[model samples]
Target: MTSPSFNPYHEWLGIDPSISAPDHYQLIGVPRDEQNPETISRAADAAMSRVRQVRPGDKSQEWARVLDELREAKSCLTNQGR
Candidate 1:
């Protein structure tokens, strides 16, 4: 079963009445950390990647993130030049 932490989308749709959706998400219990920051970072990256992989998307939807990041970088560089 998916953990309660992953229920925002369903809850937002007014589906889970027995459990009141929190005004904000509460990440209780454990802190996410690793001896190597890259390890935890990679795990989060892979999990999000798997979610996207499971839901195949249109090209723009798929590439939107990388494109947006590049655009932001270009803007930052242009501002630095001025």
Candidate 2:
């Protein structure tokens, strides 16, 4: 079992969401001290690359899951109103 705050999405992105953050930016690798679009973009790109490596077959379900998480993180990070 995992803690409620243990987001596998963070793991997939090689980030730890539990890290101290002034806000939610750390969930996707952005620094709490500063919001950088470039940094968020890089994080999203890395997640995308990781999910893309999952070829179709036995891991199709995992691929779908990771892809969904990647999209979610990207949407939150890129949406200025968020």
lDDT, candidates in the order shown: 0.34, 0.59
Instruction: Quote model 1's TM-score.
Output: 0.28
Instruction: Tell me which residue pairs clash in candidate 2.
Output: none
- As a whole number from 0 to 100, the lDDT of residue 77 in candidate 2 is 66
Over 1-82, each residue of candidate 1 has an lDDT whose tens digit, in order, gives 3344544323322324544432211111113322343443443344344334443234334344433433343333334425
Please report how far candidate 1 places residue 51 from its true position, in Å. 1.2
Worst 10 residues of 2 by lDDT: 19-28
Q: Which candidate has the highest lDDT of all? A: 2
